[model samples]
Target: MTTTTRTAVVTGAARGIGAGVAKRLAADGFAVAVIDLDEAACKPVAEEIEATGGRALAVGVDVADEQGVQAAVDRIAKELGEPTVLVNNAGIIRDNLMFKMTADDWDAVMNVHLRGSFLMTRAVQGYMTKAGWGRIVSLSSTSALGNRGQANYAAAKAGLQGFTKTLAFELGKFGVTANAIAPGFIETEMTAATAERVGMPFEEFKKAAASQIPVARTGRPADIAHAVSFFVSEGAGFVSGQVLYVAGGPKA
Candidate 1:
């Protein structure tokens, strides 16, 4: 009841963590904009929310495209209401050792993770500023802590942390809080792909990963969603500019 019917824009929401965050926000009383690279791909998540009697809208967005991002925000504003919550969750991985990493690989990761977040946030903040209340959450990763063969990804994810803090510094006066969620070992298509890249069965990979964690388990999208749920809640207004490492014990 505290969040009203504020709109929340979650990028890369077609599946995985983005979808989880979008679904959770809708349940938390926000009309969610389920955004991804393909509008059609976004429909299922939006439809699922609507089936649960929550409001949702599907949008296609190339977060790195400035004009496309602006247009997407405008559409979400006109259709679902002005978006007061923004989640920069869209990203891709081009993992390789620095020796074999290409410029294209680096650019692809940076464009989606950094430039995309930059573009989407820039487009949506106006609505938040006008309302004087907002929550901006970006997805960071444990990989940001200097993972091997992930130079580009590590840099991009690390960049999001800085971005979150800066937004907090500049937007706190507007009653907008910014935070980042750095997740570890979440089971998703992306993680599955990582396992495949290493020619390891996902179950075996998960088992190996779980053994390293104090919790002796992997994470799910819903786990990250719960953290996001709290960060965007009315009670979380004072909890900003923090990087929450949701990896079992500490160390991230």
Candidate 2:
């Protein structure tokens, strides 16, 4: 099959790392589905890809909802031509210390990260099995190593690692690869918000984070996107069930 015929679906693609992954995959010659909680939010990403002479579709989906996940995958398969690459990038943070965290906050993060990936991956794996080749990349984080004041967020991210590995084990024989990218200190709106929450200037926060990294630099969405690009590449077929840390240095 021609590269143009392949389809890639990226959730939470309205901005940040998801947008970077979507754009990169589009540039790689796959018809991309730009998905976010609001369909309208996805339009700009899809349009940007189109402006670059690539094909894309905007899909709004709540990845944690089984029906919504199914609908979104079905639509992509029909319109984009059988999605073989899936990126589970939809995530939310309910950052609070365990003492101050509400049950709702914990559940929200769990639903969005862990449950969301489960539903999306389950819905799309069928398409992959049919095609006999697929790539599944889930967004995990350095927080999975346990971040302070992020009990819910960290737990959810950590859970995705097990989810990814199990997928790799079960689906490898079907010619599908499942992996997780655990990024550290990526400069995105999410991190900016975190800085704001802690009453620090964004630049100061980033610099503080950078000082701790061996690379002496913060990360960008494109950095994680580059890693996702490799995980989804045909040459990466032999690589599966792995968690790649995209941090600037080894985890502390």
For all predicted structures, in order, the TM-scores are 0.98, 0.98
Residue 174's lDDT in candidate 2: 94
**Consecutive 10-residue window with the lowest summed lDDT within model 2:** 1-10
lDDT of 1 by residue, 117-192 (tens): 9998899888989999999999999988999999999999999999999999999999999999999999999999
Please count the clashing residue pairs in each candidate, in the order shown. Answer: 0, 0
Highest lDDT model number: 1
lDDT for each of the candidates? 0.95, 0.93
lDDT of 2 at 9: 91
Clashes of 2: 0
Which runs in model 1 stand beyond 4 Å of their true positions? 2-4
User: What tens digits encode model 2's per-residue C-alpha lDDT throughout 1-252?
Assistant: 364579999999999999999999988888999999999999999999999999999999898888988888888888887889999999998888899999999999999998999898888899899989999999999999998999998889989999999999999999999999999999999999999999999999999999999999999999999999999998999999999999999874
